[model samples]
Target: MIVIVDYGLGNLGSIKNMLRKIGYSSMVSSNPDEISKASKLILPGVGAFDTGMRHLTDSGLLDILGYKALAEKIPVLGICLGAQLMTRSSEEGCLSGLGWFEAETLKFQFDGIAGKWPLPNIGWRDVFDVNGSPLLSGFNSTPRFYFVHSYFLKPLEQDIVSMNVSYGFEYACGLSKGNLHCVQFHPEKSHKFGMQLLRNFSELT
Candidate 1:
Protein backbone atom coordinates (compact mmCIF):
# COMPACT_ATOMS: atom_id res chain seq x y z
CA MET A 1 0.00 0.00 0.00
CA ILE A 2 1.11 3.57 -0.60
CA VAL A 3 2.03 5.42 2.58
CA ILE A 4 1.32 9.12 2.76
CA VAL A 5 3.55 10.72 5.35
CA ASP A 6 1.51 12.95 7.65
CA TYR A 7 3.57 15.54 9.41
CA GLY A 8 0.73 18.00 9.76
CA LEU A 9 2.20 20.14 6.99
CA GLY A 10 0.53 19.00 3.80
CA ASN A 11 -2.82 19.04 2.03
CA LEU A 12 -3.33 15.55 3.38
CA GLY A 13 -7.07 15.17 3.10
CA SER A 14 -7.33 16.47 -0.45
CA ILE A 15 -4.55 14.14 -1.56
CA LYS A 16 -6.19 11.18 0.14
CA ASN A 17 -9.52 12.00 -1.45
CA MET A 18 -7.86 12.42 -4.82
CA LEU A 19 -6.22 9.02 -4.48
CA ARG A 20 -9.54 7.43 -3.65
CA LYS A 21 -11.10 9.05 -6.68
CA ILE A 22 -8.36 7.49 -8.77
CA GLY A 23 -9.09 4.10 -7.11
CA TYR A 24 -5.82 4.08 -5.22
CA SER A 25 -6.84 4.13 -1.58
CA SER A 26 -3.74 4.80 0.48
CA MET A 27 -2.90 4.52 4.16
CA VAL A 28 -1.91 7.83 5.64
CA SER A 29 0.48 6.89 8.42
CA SER A 30 3.21 8.22 10.64
CA ASN A 31 4.01 4.85 12.20
CA PRO A 32 7.53 3.58 11.61
CA ASP A 33 6.57 0.03 10.66
CA GLU A 34 3.91 1.17 8.23
CA ILE A 35 6.31 3.44 6.40
CA SER A 36 9.05 0.80 6.22
CA LYS A 37 6.70 -1.76 4.73
CA ALA A 38 4.98 0.66 2.38
CA SER A 39 5.01 -0.24 -1.30
CA LYS A 40 5.38 3.40 -2.18
CA LEU A 41 6.25 6.55 -0.24
CA ILE A 42 4.46 9.79 -1.06
CA LEU A 43 6.06 12.80 0.57
CA PRO A 44 3.49 15.57 0.16
CA GLY A 45 3.59 18.98 1.78
CA VAL A 46 1.88 22.38 1.79
CA GLY A 47 3.68 24.80 4.11
CA ALA A 48 6.88 26.66 4.75
CA PHE A 49 10.08 24.66 4.13
CA ASP A 50 11.66 25.19 7.54
CA THR A 51 8.45 24.57 9.44
CA GLY A 52 7.79 21.37 7.50
CA MET A 53 11.32 20.12 8.04
CA ARG A 54 11.07 20.82 11.75
CA HIS A 55 7.82 18.92 12.02
CA LEU A 56 9.24 15.95 10.16
CA THR A 57 12.27 15.78 12.41
CA ASP A 58 10.29 16.26 15.63
CA SER A 59 7.93 13.50 14.58
CA GLY A 60 10.84 11.12 13.85
CA LEU A 61 9.46 10.53 10.37
CA LEU A 62 12.32 12.25 8.59
CA ASP A 63 14.93 9.69 9.56
CA ILE A 64 12.62 6.83 8.70
CA LEU A 65 11.90 8.37 5.31
CA GLY A 66 15.57 8.94 4.65
CA TYR A 67 16.38 5.34 5.49
CA LYS A 68 13.63 4.13 3.21
CA ALA A 69 14.76 6.24 0.26
CA LEU A 70 18.53 6.01 0.61
CA ALA A 71 18.89 2.43 1.86
CA GLU A 72 15.83 0.54 0.66
CA LYS A 73 15.65 2.66 -2.48
CA ILE A 74 11.91 2.27 -2.54
CA PRO A 75 9.96 3.91 -5.34
CA VAL A 76 9.13 7.31 -3.88
CA LEU A 77 7.38 10.44 -5.09
CA GLY A 78 7.48 14.01 -3.74
CA ILE A 79 5.16 16.87 -4.59
CA CYS A 80 5.79 20.63 -4.32
CA LEU A 81 7.19 21.35 -0.86
CA GLY A 82 7.94 17.67 -0.59
CA ALA A 83 9.81 17.88 -3.90
CA GLN A 84 11.73 20.88 -2.67
CA LEU A 85 12.78 18.91 0.43
CA MET A 86 14.08 16.16 -1.87
CA THR A 87 16.80 18.56 -2.91
CA ARG A 88 20.03 19.25 -1.00
CA SER A 89 18.68 22.45 0.54
CA SER A 90 16.34 25.39 0.07
CA GLU A 91 16.60 29.15 0.54
CA GLU A 92 13.14 29.51 2.06
CA GLY A 93 13.71 30.45 5.71
CA CYS A 94 17.20 28.92 5.22
CA LEU A 95 15.63 25.49 5.18
CA SER A 96 17.56 22.24 5.12
CA GLY A 97 15.67 19.68 3.08
CA LEU A 98 15.70 15.90 3.07
CA GLY A 99 18.53 15.97 0.53
CA TRP A 100 17.43 13.01 -1.58
CA PHE A 101 17.59 14.55 -5.04
CA GLU A 102 20.64 16.37 -6.31
CA ALA A 103 19.08 19.77 -6.66
CA GLU A 104 18.93 23.08 -4.82
CA THR A 105 15.96 25.35 -4.21
CA LEU A 106 16.29 29.08 -4.83
CA LYS A 107 14.04 32.08 -4.39
CA PHE A 108 12.80 34.06 -7.38
CA GLN A 109 15.28 36.57 -8.76
CA PHE A 110 15.09 37.68 -12.41
CA ASP A 111 13.20 40.80 -11.32
CA GLY A 112 12.60 41.93 -14.89
CA ILE A 113 11.40 38.47 -15.90
CA ALA A 114 9.21 37.77 -12.87
CA GLY A 115 7.59 41.18 -13.27
CA LYS A 116 5.79 39.75 -16.31
CA TRP A 117 4.60 36.63 -14.45
CA PRO A 118 2.85 35.93 -11.17
CA LEU A 119 4.43 34.90 -7.87
CA PRO A 120 3.45 31.79 -5.88
CA ASN A 121 2.77 30.50 -9.43
CA ILE A 122 -0.68 29.35 -8.44
CA GLY A 123 -3.26 27.74 -10.78
CA TRP A 124 -2.67 25.59 -13.88
CA ARG A 125 0.51 25.63 -15.93
CA ASP A 126 1.79 23.20 -18.56
CA VAL A 127 4.83 21.04 -17.91
CA PHE A 128 7.27 19.82 -20.54
CA ASP A 129 8.29 16.25 -19.79
CA VAL A 130 12.00 16.28 -20.60
CA ASN A 131 13.02 12.77 -19.44
CA GLY A 132 9.77 10.95 -20.26
CA SER A 133 9.49 8.64 -17.25
CA PRO A 134 6.74 6.05 -16.95
CA LEU A 135 5.66 7.71 -13.72
CA LEU A 136 4.01 10.24 -16.01
CA SER A 137 2.73 7.71 -18.54
CA GLY A 138 -0.37 8.64 -20.58
CA PHE A 139 0.46 12.27 -19.92
CA ASN A 140 1.62 14.56 -22.68
CA SER A 141 5.08 16.01 -22.95
CA THR A 142 3.34 19.29 -22.22
CA PRO A 143 0.36 18.82 -19.94
CA ARG A 144 -1.17 21.27 -17.52
CA PHE A 145 -0.64 20.69 -13.77
CA TYR A 146 -1.36 22.71 -10.68
CA PHE A 147 1.37 24.74 -8.97
CA VAL A 148 1.66 27.13 -5.95
CA HIS A 149 5.03 28.24 -4.77
CA SER A 150 7.50 31.13 -4.78
CA TYR A 151 10.83 29.28 -5.08
CA PHE A 152 12.05 27.12 -7.97
CA LEU A 153 14.51 24.26 -8.16
CA LYS A 154 17.18 23.33 -10.75
CA PRO A 155 18.90 19.99 -10.95
CA LEU A 156 22.54 20.15 -10.06
CA GLU A 157 23.08 18.00 -13.15
CA GLN A 158 20.97 17.84 -16.28
CA ASP A 159 21.25 14.06 -16.61
CA ILE A 160 19.18 13.49 -13.47
CA VAL A 161 16.59 16.14 -14.34
CA SER A 162 13.75 15.39 -16.73
CA MET A 163 10.99 18.03 -17.12
CA ASN A 164 11.10 21.80 -17.38
CA VAL A 165 8.32 24.41 -16.88
CA SER A 166 8.50 28.06 -17.78
CA TYR A 167 7.64 30.92 -15.48
CA GLY A 168 9.87 33.98 -15.75
CA PHE A 169 12.45 31.50 -17.02
CA GLU A 170 12.37 27.76 -17.64
CA TYR A 171 13.23 25.66 -14.58
CA ALA A 172 13.14 22.05 -13.56
CA CYS A 173 9.52 21.06 -13.06
CA GLY A 174 9.94 17.33 -12.61
CA LEU A 175 12.92 15.32 -11.43
CA SER A 176 13.55 11.56 -11.69
CA LYS A 177 16.53 9.28 -11.16
CA GLY A 178 16.43 5.55 -10.53
CA ASN A 179 13.56 4.79 -8.12
CA LEU A 180 13.08 8.36 -7.02
CA HIS A 181 10.67 10.71 -8.79
CA CYS A 182 9.62 14.23 -7.84
CA VAL A 183 7.18 16.70 -9.34
CA GLN A 184 6.59 20.35 -8.62
CA PHE A 185 2.89 20.29 -9.54
CA HIS A 186 0.04 18.98 -7.41
CA PRO A 187 -1.48 16.02 -9.26
CA GLU A 188 -4.21 15.77 -6.65
CA LYS A 189 -5.38 19.24 -7.68
CA SER A 190 -4.68 19.05 -11.44
CA HIS A 191 -8.08 17.60 -12.42
CA LYS A 192 -8.00 14.98 -15.21
CA PHE A 193 -4.42 15.61 -16.20
CA GLY A 194 -3.34 15.38 -12.59
CA MET A 195 -5.39 12.26 -12.03
CA GLN A 196 -3.64 10.49 -14.88
CA LEU A 197 -0.25 11.41 -13.51
CA LEU A 198 -1.14 10.05 -10.06
CA ARG A 199 -2.49 6.88 -11.60
CA ASN A 200 0.68 6.51 -13.62
CA PHE A 201 2.74 6.79 -10.46
CA SER A 202 0.59 4.28 -8.57
CA GLU A 203 1.34 1.57 -11.16
CA LEU A 204 4.76 2.73 -12.29
CA THR A 205 7.57 0.21 -12.40
Candidate 2:
Protein backbone atom coordinates (compact mmCIF):
# COMPACT_ATOMS: atom_id res chain seq x y z
CA MET A 1 0.00 0.00 0.00
CA ILE A 2 1.09 3.58 -0.60
CA VAL A 3 1.97 5.35 2.65
CA ILE A 4 1.79 9.05 3.38
CA VAL A 5 4.37 10.14 5.92
CA ASP A 6 2.70 11.99 8.78
CA TYR A 7 5.28 13.86 10.82
CA GLY A 8 2.89 16.53 12.12
CA LEU A 9 2.82 18.73 9.00
CA GLY A 10 0.97 18.99 5.70
CA ASN A 11 -2.65 18.53 4.58
CA LEU A 12 -2.65 14.79 5.03
CA GLY A 13 -6.40 14.50 4.67
CA SER A 14 -6.49 16.26 1.30
CA ILE A 15 -3.72 14.03 -0.09
CA LYS A 16 -5.45 10.90 1.16
CA ASN A 17 -8.76 12.09 -0.28
CA MET A 18 -7.17 12.72 -3.64
CA LEU A 19 -5.61 9.27 -3.69
CA ARG A 20 -8.96 7.71 -2.79
CA LYS A 21 -10.55 9.56 -5.71
CA ILE A 22 -7.97 7.93 -7.97
CA GLY A 23 -8.96 4.52 -6.55
CA TYR A 24 -5.69 4.06 -4.67
CA SER A 25 -5.42 2.97 -1.07
CA SER A 26 -3.10 5.05 1.11
CA MET A 27 -2.47 5.28 4.81
CA VAL A 28 -1.22 8.29 6.74
CA SER A 29 1.22 7.24 9.44
CA SER A 30 4.34 8.24 11.35
CA ASN A 31 5.14 4.67 12.25
CA PRO A 32 8.55 3.73 10.92
CA ASP A 33 7.52 0.13 10.28
CA GLU A 34 4.56 1.13 8.14
CA ILE A 35 6.65 3.66 6.28
CA SER A 36 9.46 1.19 5.65
CA LYS A 37 7.03 -1.32 4.17
CA ALA A 38 5.28 1.11 1.85
CA SER A 39 5.19 0.08 -1.81
CA LYS A 40 5.22 3.78 -2.69
CA LEU A 41 5.52 6.85 -0.49
CA ILE A 42 4.24 10.40 -0.47
CA LEU A 43 5.90 13.06 1.64
CA PRO A 44 3.57 16.01 2.12
CA GLY A 45 4.38 19.19 4.03
CA VAL A 46 3.15 22.74 4.51
CA GLY A 47 5.27 24.78 6.89
CA ALA A 48 8.74 26.17 7.55
CA PHE A 49 11.71 24.15 6.25
CA ASP A 50 13.41 23.82 9.62
CA THR A 51 10.16 22.95 11.36
CA GLY A 52 9.34 20.21 8.88
CA MET A 53 12.82 18.76 9.12
CA ARG A 54 12.72 18.92 12.89
CA HIS A 55 9.41 17.10 13.00
CA LEU A 56 10.74 14.36 10.78
CA THR A 57 13.84 14.03 12.91
CA ASP A 58 11.99 14.13 16.21
CA SER A 59 9.51 11.54 15.03
CA GLY A 60 12.38 9.27 14.00
CA LEU A 61 11.10 9.29 10.43
CA LEU A 62 14.04 11.21 9.02
CA ASP A 63 16.36 8.24 8.97
CA ILE A 64 13.62 5.74 8.14
CA LEU A 65 12.41 7.72 5.13
CA GLY A 66 15.97 8.42 4.02
CA TYR A 67 16.73 4.71 4.05
CA LYS A 68 13.57 3.69 2.23
CA ALA A 69 13.74 6.35 -0.44
CA LEU A 70 17.49 6.50 -0.97
CA ALA A 71 18.97 3.20 0.12
CA GLU A 72 16.04 0.96 -0.77
CA LYS A 73 15.21 3.00 -3.90
CA ILE A 74 11.51 3.09 -3.24
CA PRO A 75 9.49 5.35 -5.50
CA VAL A 76 8.82 8.51 -3.47
CA LEU A 77 6.99 11.72 -4.26
CA GLY A 78 7.41 14.93 -2.24
CA ILE A 79 4.89 17.75 -2.45
CA CYS A 80 5.68 21.43 -1.86
CA LEU A 81 7.65 21.82 1.36
CA GLY A 82 8.25 18.09 1.26
CA ALA A 83 9.80 18.60 -2.16
CA GLN A 84 12.04 21.31 -0.83
CA LEU A 85 13.18 19.00 1.92
CA MET A 86 14.52 16.56 -0.66
CA THR A 87 17.24 19.01 -1.55
CA ARG A 88 20.63 19.53 0.11
CA SER A 89 19.62 22.64 2.05
CA SER A 90 17.41 25.70 2.01
CA GLU A 91 17.87 29.43 2.43
CA GLU A 92 14.68 29.30 4.46
CA GLY A 93 16.55 27.33 7.13
CA CYS A 94 20.06 26.47 8.22
CA LEU A 95 19.43 22.78 8.82
CA SER A 96 20.50 20.35 6.11
CA GLY A 97 17.91 18.50 4.02
CA LEU A 98 17.50 14.86 3.09
CA GLY A 99 19.95 15.50 0.19
CA TRP A 100 18.11 13.17 -2.17
CA PHE A 101 18.64 15.74 -4.93
CA GLU A 102 21.62 17.97 -5.61
CA ALA A 103 19.53 21.08 -5.16
CA GLU A 104 18.76 23.87 -2.76
CA THR A 105 15.56 25.63 -1.80
CA LEU A 106 15.67 29.39 -2.24
CA LYS A 107 13.30 32.22 -1.50
CA PHE A 108 12.00 33.97 -4.60
CA GLN A 109 13.61 37.36 -5.04
CA PHE A 110 11.64 40.11 -6.72
CA ASP A 111 14.85 41.70 -8.07
CA GLY A 112 14.44 43.07 -11.62
CA ILE A 113 10.95 41.65 -12.03
CA ALA A 114 9.58 43.70 -9.18
CA GLY A 115 5.79 44.40 -9.23
CA LYS A 116 5.27 41.88 -12.05
CA TRP A 117 4.11 39.30 -9.49
CA PRO A 118 3.70 38.90 -5.78
CA LEU A 119 5.53 36.83 -3.22
CA PRO A 120 4.22 33.44 -2.04
CA ASN A 121 3.10 32.81 -5.62
CA ILE A 122 -0.51 31.86 -5.14
CA GLY A 123 -3.29 30.63 -7.51
CA TRP A 124 -3.22 28.68 -10.78
CA ARG A 125 -0.16 28.77 -13.05
CA ASP A 126 0.82 26.97 -16.21
CA VAL A 127 3.50 24.26 -16.14
CA PHE A 128 5.20 22.77 -19.17
CA ASP A 129 6.28 19.15 -19.06
CA VAL A 130 9.64 19.70 -20.65
CA ASN A 131 10.78 16.08 -20.40
CA GLY A 132 7.38 14.38 -20.72
CA SER A 133 8.03 12.21 -17.68
CA PRO A 134 5.87 9.25 -16.84
CA LEU A 135 4.86 11.09 -13.68
CA LEU A 136 3.29 13.74 -15.88
CA SER A 137 1.69 11.29 -18.32
CA GLY A 138 -1.55 12.24 -20.11
CA PHE A 139 -0.96 15.98 -20.04
CA ASN A 140 -1.70 16.50 -23.72
CA SER A 141 -2.25 20.21 -23.33
CA THR A 142 -0.59 22.84 -21.19
CA PRO A 143 -1.64 22.00 -17.65
CA ARG A 144 -2.13 24.45 -14.83
CA PHE A 145 -1.38 23.58 -11.22
CA TYR A 146 -2.06 25.42 -8.01
CA PHE A 147 0.96 26.87 -6.23
CA VAL A 148 1.38 28.73 -2.94
CA HIS A 149 4.95 29.14 -1.91
CA SER A 150 7.55 31.80 -1.25
CA TYR A 151 10.47 29.52 -2.13
CA PHE A 152 11.37 27.29 -5.11
CA LEU A 153 13.87 24.53 -5.67
CA LYS A 154 17.08 25.11 -7.67
CA PRO A 155 18.38 21.76 -8.80
CA LEU A 156 22.01 21.71 -9.84
CA GLU A 157 21.31 19.00 -12.39
CA GLN A 158 18.94 20.43 -14.97
CA ASP A 159 18.37 17.01 -16.56
CA ILE A 160 16.37 15.88 -13.54
CA VAL A 161 13.85 18.66 -14.06
CA SER A 162 10.69 17.24 -15.57
CA MET A 163 8.58 20.42 -15.57
CA ASN A 164 9.08 24.16 -15.43
CA VAL A 165 6.76 27.03 -14.51
CA SER A 166 7.09 30.75 -15.05
CA TYR A 167 6.48 33.19 -12.27
CA GLY A 168 8.52 36.41 -12.28
CA PHE A 169 10.98 34.15 -14.13
CA GLU A 170 11.07 30.47 -15.03
CA TYR A 171 11.88 27.96 -12.31
CA ALA A 172 12.00 24.21 -11.91
CA CYS A 173 8.70 23.12 -10.41
CA GLY A 174 8.90 19.41 -11.04
CA LEU A 175 11.83 17.00 -10.68
CA SER A 176 12.28 13.28 -11.30
CA LYS A 177 15.40 11.16 -10.90
CA GLY A 178 15.44 7.44 -10.40
CA ASN A 179 13.14 6.63 -7.46
CA LEU A 180 12.80 10.29 -6.42
CA HIS A 181 10.12 12.61 -7.79
CA CYS A 182 8.80 15.94 -6.57
CA VAL A 183 6.44 18.78 -7.45
CA GLN A 184 6.40 22.31 -6.08
CA PHE A 185 2.72 22.70 -6.96
CA HIS A 186 -0.14 21.00 -5.22
CA PRO A 187 -1.46 18.21 -7.46
CA GLU A 188 -4.11 17.39 -4.89
CA LYS A 189 -5.65 20.79 -5.62
CA SER A 190 -4.93 20.84 -9.37
CA HIS A 191 -8.23 19.10 -10.33
CA LYS A 192 -8.20 16.65 -13.25
CA PHE A 193 -4.56 17.26 -14.15
CA GLY A 194 -3.52 16.56 -10.59
CA MET A 195 -5.65 13.43 -10.49
CA GLN A 196 -3.99 12.10 -13.59
CA LEU A 197 -0.54 12.72 -12.13
CA LEU A 198 -1.43 10.88 -8.95
CA ARG A 199 -2.81 7.99 -10.96
CA ASN A 200 0.37 7.90 -12.97
CA PHE A 201 2.48 7.73 -9.83
CA SER A 202 0.35 4.85 -8.53
CA GLU A 203 1.09 2.85 -11.65
CA LEU A 204 4.87 3.24 -11.34
CA THR A 205 6.87 0.17 -10.41
RMSD in Å for all candidates: 1.6, 1.0
lDDT per model, in order?
0.84, 0.92
Candidate 2 — which residues are off by over 4 angstroms?
none
On residues 43-112, what C-alpha lDDT tens digit does candidate 2 reach at each position?
9999999999999889988888988898898899999999999999999999999999999999998787
lDDT of 2: 0.92
Which candidate comes out best when scored by TM-score? 2
Compose the digit string of candidate 1's lDDT tens values, residues 149-190. Answer: 998887898977777888888899889988898988898888
| Candidate 1: clashing pairs of residues | none
